[model samples]
Target: MNQRYTGTAIFLHWLIAVGLIGVFALGFYMQDLPLSPDKLKLYSWHKWAGVTLLVLIVARLAWRLSHRAPELPLTMGPITRMAAHAGHWLLYGLMLAIPLSGWLMSSAQGFQVVWFGVLPLPDLVAKDAALGALLKTTHVTLNYTLLVAVIGHVGAALQHHFIQKDAVLSHMLPFAGKA
Candidate 1:
């Protein structure tokens, strides 16, 4: 069996990873900005990024469903393997949830999402300032949760590389070959 993931999978993974970081950071940076033209623009960009990420994640999930991932390292025990799988699923869930939460928050705040400033997305919920506040909190909380999960994911990959000295991390690296 191949030691590395398919090229398409690697591409989508990195693309989504980059998008996640950009959108997450933008959200953090813009949340406290005083309402001005620039802040409004930043918020629009953030929304666009979030919407784009949602599409990318759905595509990634579909691809994952269709394509079997390379097997885990043989050295990992059953419990470790289970944890890894659970961690991956959690990441996927957060990836999907965060954007939807943001979108719903925007909707509750009566702001329409315009994808890439071209396509306008429908509101997900009725306008309610209270609900908007709650969803904003939910979105922030989920993003931080994802941050923790991502740290764990990266740590596990590093452990595989440095401690186990396995090809696990290499499996996802671009242009990586058999170990």
Candidate 2:
């Protein structure tokens, strides 16, 4: 077995991870700011980042579907393997859901989302303040969910590296490790 992910996979993994964390922090930071032109600008920037993230995630998913990931070691416990599988699937689901919820919220709030202030995107839902509020809440809730999942994901990676002494983490790293 290769015992390592493809270079493209590793690149997309880190790119998406960093982008998610950045957007999450930006989302929290922007929510409490007093209404002003700056706040509006921040919101637009946040939406732009979210849309970019959606694109990256879609590309990553397509790549993952087309390529085979390196297998876990034979020594890995079945329970651990199952947990890893579930964690990965949860991450994928949240990645898609979080941005989608944000896009829907913006649409429902009657805000047109323009990518980086360049290209305008279609609305996912009709303008409805009530629906906007609901979708906003959903977006916030999913953000926290994504945060927890990310923490757990990192913890598991550390556990695999330091405790399990396995190549699980290394598999995704852009470096050499024992197979």
Give the whole-model CA lDDT for all candidates, comma-separated.
0.93, 0.91
77-172 per-residue lDDT for model 1 (tens digits): 999999999999999999999999999999999999988888989999999999999998999999999999999999999999999999999989
Model 2 segments beyond 4 Å from truth? none
Worst lDDT 10-window in candidate 1: 1-10
Candidate 2: the clashing residue pairs are: none
* lDDT assessment of candidate 2: 0.91
In candidate 1, the residue pairs with backbone N, CA or C atoms under 3 Å apart (3 or more residues apart, or in different chains) clash, namely none
lDDT of 2 by residue, 1-179 (tens): 66788889999999998898888888899999999999999999999999999999999999988998889878888998898889988989999999999999999999999998989999989999999999999999998998899899999989988998978888888775555
C-alpha RMSD in Å of predicted model 2 compared with the true structure: 1.1
**Cα error, candidate 1, residue 46 (Å):** 0.5
